[model samples]
Target: MATGVMTPDERAFRGDLRKAPFMLGELEGRWKLESLEWPNALIDVTARDGLPYRLRFDLTNYPAAPPTARLWSRVENAALAPGLFPRSITGSGRVKDVFRTDWMNGTALYLPCDRTALAGHESWLQQMPSKRWQPSVGITHYLELVHELLNCPDYAPPAGA
Candidate 1:
């Protein structure tokens, strides 16, 4: 359903959707917006393994506050269960802390780009400045990071997921 008139955040989001990176991702079938309802946008991202993970982005406050993402469970129509979350960012049995299921009760990513995760991780601002969120970079910045992680050579999908 239409999410009413486009607010500033929605406008900015649509602008990012028009950007080359997002456009190319759509063309390549890498990232696809599955749904949009005001503060919530569900995006399906394809992993290198040819599987897809649906992420729900909470865009409330948006640019002023970095949007947070959670792995979505189509079956449950809720957040993906922690036990079923992706196991590792690499295939060598090492889990990347950013996508750890234990963080935020498995509700969000642990990256500095995430609003919730960045709360106690302010040091990332200087430690990983480039990865940190800046309003000017837009939502694609978040999606791009996720895309990169899921497509990296080390990414390992959860068994039977």
Candidate 2:
């Protein structure tokens, strides 16, 4: 049932999962944990306007460096409209398109932009408690912040704001 030999990071990830089992729940209209691959976890959520999306959390160096979140699934016109969705932030604090569409499949993982005119902003990821992350913060807290960002319009900065 387990995949190959577990790395120390994987073991830590499992321990974190155990400490926050509720993070995996499907509580009707809420984000649900889909799959977990050691330092990466996938979550499914429906945007406020009813668009479905997948969120990937990369937990490598977690608790030290905040997890990097990437949006997944096809982008809807509404989702791409200026202030509708989250955007990705560069390491230098600049905003960048979340997906590199030109890359080959699997090689390039990003939100689909067929219908969107603007890239969504990633206020939540950028504002994550990176400087404040501690062993006690855990994934549950991180995900709760994500839920707030997606469902609570006021939580995310208006695109370009």
Candidate 3:
């Protein structure tokens, strides 16, 4: 935990991760939580390519609101360049749609679980109810989706890489 004033959301999010799902994954070496500082949680996801990439999750309202997750550049200490985003996939158009460069200036992944993308996409809740984020869902609901996306067979390294 960072030495700062943590809000209710941060406290809740931290507590959620300490539970079984996140802890089991961490213990199993599926992913490593690098650091958590309130709204930002930088995690290193081990990809199918045997390389690791970091994601910085913006957890503003947290459980009440979906997170805005972005690929992170640890060196730059900023969002990864748009060109380096994992916006390509070979297997399914549905998956490709979620990893796009056309929405929100490509700041966040275009998943129904993302805060910014989920705003006007309320229809996703009814159409693909399972994909929608709800207050009852934990951070694992979103992180697991990201893990799938990164490990999917069709996933490829970014063009810049």
lDDT of each: 0.81, 0.48, 0.77
- Candidate 3 deviant stretches above 4 angstroms: 1-5, 87-95
Q: TM-scores for all candidates?
A: 0.89, 0.51, 0.86
Writing each residue's lDDT as its tens digit, candidate 3 over 16-129 gives 888898888777666779998778899877667755678889988888888888778878988777676664465345446766666666678788888888888888888887
Select the stronger candidate by lDDT from 1 and 3: 1
* Collision pairs in model 2: 86-121, 87-121, 87-122
Q: Write the per-residue lDDT of candidate 1 for residues 10-60, one digit (tens) a residue.
A: 877878778897788878988898888877999988888877888999998
Query: What's the CA RMSD for each of the models?
Result: 2.4, 9.9, 2.5
lDDT value for candidate 1?
A: 0.81
lDDT of 2 by residue, 1-161 (tens): 46588766666666776663444535555667778876778766654545555666777765544465556533441112334344343221112233332323222223221112112424433553352334565665545544544555333332553
Which ten residues in a row are the worst by lDDT in model 2? Answer: 109-118
Error of 2 at 45 (Å): 3.2
